[model samples]
Target: MSKILDAFLNENLEALRDQGLYNEIDAVEGANGPIIQVNGKKLINLSSNNYLGLATNEELKQVAKKAIDEYGVGAGAVRTINGTMDLHVKLEEKLAEFKGTEAAISYQSGFNCNMAAISAVMDKNDAILSDQLNHASIIDGCRLSKAKIIAYKHSDMDDLRTKAKEAKESGLYNKIMVITDGVFSMDGDIAKLPEIVEIAKEFDLITYVDDAHGSGVTGKGKGTVKHFGLEKEIDFQIGTLSKAIGVVGGYVAGKKNLIDWLKVRSRPFLFSTAVTPGDVAAITRAVEMIMESTELHDRLWENGDYLKAGLKKLGFEIGASETPITPCIIGDEKLTQQFSKRLVEEGVYAKAIVFPTVPKGTGRVRNMPTAAHTKEMLDDALAIYEKVGRELGVIN
Candidate 1:
């Protein structure tokens, strides 16, 4: 409608295409699982975040259907209004238990949880010491808080300590918070939470951890805080119900006072409609399963190890990944995109990560091996990787 708006959008879109940065979304034809059908082609999927492969679990699906039958499709109103149902309450209780916290509060999504919780607690009077490589959601959350943000070297405890000391001694803010991702998704490295906790204790800083990628994958499905046995020490533990839990929504687990504060002050929770009853039920069931057994978690790691071993054997430069997330590094961005395209053509579906998402010249095809993937599926995916890597001169 507006010519200036049109021109601005067109110019930016063309620039993205010209730079080979435009992402083309692929439509999945059926359930997203170990194997997915994309554009009429069946491929071994290594691009999904369904860590434990519970996204398509039959039991969870059944529970969701039952919930739908009892409570309908939607929650009907905002959480502060009439939307907080029995299922919602139960999910929060289950999340607190799972995360080993005194209380928990849920939101529509993980992104919203970060955006809501961070700003609600920290404000202009505070300073946030964040990890350089933390998730974009954390960055946006900090900005929204209007706090002085000081970024430290990624996972470098020394840098964190230095920044913390400076911020505290300056007396520029009333409160200081240190936030980091429990597991750095891109490199698949676990954060040094123990060292961070020690630093926080020394400075009396409020500690926050976004463990969206760690829940159900670490700490025997409890999460990274439990992984390091610092459940009571950390103040905020944010997680998603969508990733390993295989549903929708996010939550912040902490003390009862913090949870109560979020319930009243978090704008998203107060104004937005609550998560669907089916999703809440499914997520609760999924967490129950994770706590009940460690079978899925073990299978996920086994598959990750098998795939990593195969890629290394084929001479591909798989980067330093301590978790199930693997990255086949291809230094050039265009070539990295081409490598991912070739993988898709050969019956594997892994996506490329380039600048903005990752540093320039470190473009990579990130693979996420799930618990549902059988050895045969992984072997086939490995074969495709080797073929593509060798053909593209990415490997010997």
Candidate 2:
């Protein structure tokens, strides 16, 4: 309530509003499924990261309900303090099996996973070669480690190789790590993990991949590491249970030693309360479902393709997205926000992404078509897009 603090907040907030950079949050009326209700208006949702539609799967819901009856809702305390639960242990084991790793350790969320794991293994004496478009969590994690961060051009293998070679040859650090997102969320592009793995081997750099947007949506639902068969080559496989897995937590899958070290040293795991018993149970079941069948994953990709094709055919500047995440690029910030608003007004809830989430002047309305979306739903969305696109002059 100090005058200085009030002035600082007022000035920055006004600046953001003037520049069309301030985000307005909307509340979903019920579940965040394929169709959502906002302010009592039902709409086809295209902005969720729930890739495989597992978030609303009936079987998973039943599993969580059963778990709550048996184990209660909360886990009581941190894993180290109150001891780990059986569900927690089972989820970790399933995660390791799913990722084809020797062991795995869980965290409160995907963002916390990166923040904990990176700083635990690397320190001031180490250096990290990070991709330019990695998630904000990875960037913060590298900073937390106090390591010298060398950013390469986004998915530019040549730039990565040059940086890796220079960092290695300089002998300026004890350990060098290369980190990237398995899938760039904004562009929906898959990272070149094969090339990155090759470069890592040549430079003896420790490899870390944050596949938050890839799991349960790629590699028949195993992930990008498995998509490229780099299970053993990549040193760290980081992911979230919240997205495709449809739960609430994050994890790192790797060698037994790495898991052991993280269990002891990762601050989040050591300090934060363990995932709720119900969530842990449901996460284990979700991973099992992904391992047992690829029906959801296949349907997700089909929806993605259908949506992307429709957007492109309408003359919208859909970006180069390799996965199911589709982005309709609108260069001007205000216009992009207006486009998103129009889509929402027309009953399609595709949100505008701008500023720090991506770069200025490259605003977009990102769409994520999940497995739960039927052809009829998609057709309706496309029709809405056409109307909005024509109205906004985004497409002919």
Candidate 3:
């Protein structure tokens, strides 16, 4: 290794350590479910985004296993080449149908989809009005597009309108687009899509919603775009299969022309190998299951409401969350990290979010209530929370 590179890495790592910003990755010993075993300790899990609990469903596993037996494992090449399988085409068809769009295109991961899709359409001459708190993937995508990105205040429709107007009126670009997360993951707040749509209409700005955490948790599991009944209004309806869908990969559901363009032009799609057969199979089965029964979705919401009410009653400042994503707003970053460590020691495994991931001074402990969590499990987790809260002097 180069001595200069080693010194640079060491200096940055030491800075992170001194600031207590470096996170240590803990290996989970068993399956990730409502509860996960980390370092030989079984903890009541509140850190997962597996909302529908489709990740461990037996049927989904069977589908994946069957695909593996038939199609081997990897796609073996890029989508534009011989990597495209019949199953890939099938999955795309299912996703488009699920999202109620003209056509859909899939990518290796949700992050890549954002990176691939945004740049596929928009160029440097264009301008993108992005939400201040939109997912990092979307921000990176906007950057990759070379579009002039102007950030509007989080979910502020008026601010979006003002920026969109400014971007258009200044005659600085050819087209303007507004990109936002369907649900802000950090705050668990739902996006005001109705108002956003109205602004987009007013400014003729193309609408893009990255619903990575919205699908399989909202709209009877259809997604946020459908939840707001704006299926036809949004230009790009983006989502992830890894979360509630119980698998991996991401997609862009939109007009057929757009899908076709992405298939031809997107760098990741052209360069990266297709998703594995097992993941594709499992995701397709997950979609089918959601379409068939509301059992999981209903249970997920029940747990969410239950947990939210429990946290609020405990005197924890659970932020303005409308979904299963909940955050215990603890201010100090170091204290928040310590709190999370204590929670894990107490057999609860929710994680901490600090500066950079969230704004400085707004450090929080995020919880994700999933369908797999029973009331008994949630109650046990809450008991641990109460114990930890008192022990840490966070609650009386």
Candidate 2 deviant stretches above 4 angstroms: none
What lDDT would each prediction earn against the true structure? 0.93, 0.94, 0.91
Clash totals, every prediction: 0, 0, 0
In candidate 1, position 186 carries an lDDT of: 90
TM-score for candidate 3: 0.98
**Candidate 1: Cα lDDT at 159:** 95
TM, every model: 0.99, 0.99, 0.98
Per-residue lDDT over 297-338 for candidate 2, one digit per residue giving the tens place of the 0 to 100 score? 999999999999998998989989999999999988999999
Please report how far candidate 1 places residue 114 from its true position, in Å. Answer: 0.5
lDDT (10s digit) by residue, model 3, range 1-396: 899999999999998766657777889887899889998899999998788988888888889999999999898888888988899989999999999999999998999999999999999999999989989999999999999999999888888888888888899899999899998999999999999999889879889999999998889899899999999999999999999998889999999999999999999999999999888888887888888888999999999999999999999999899899999998888888989999999899999998678997888999999999989999998998999898888899
Error of 1 at 273 (Å): 0.3
Candidate 1 at residue 166, lDDT?
A: 95
Q: Each candidate's root-mean-square deviation in Å?
A: 0.8, 0.7, 1.0
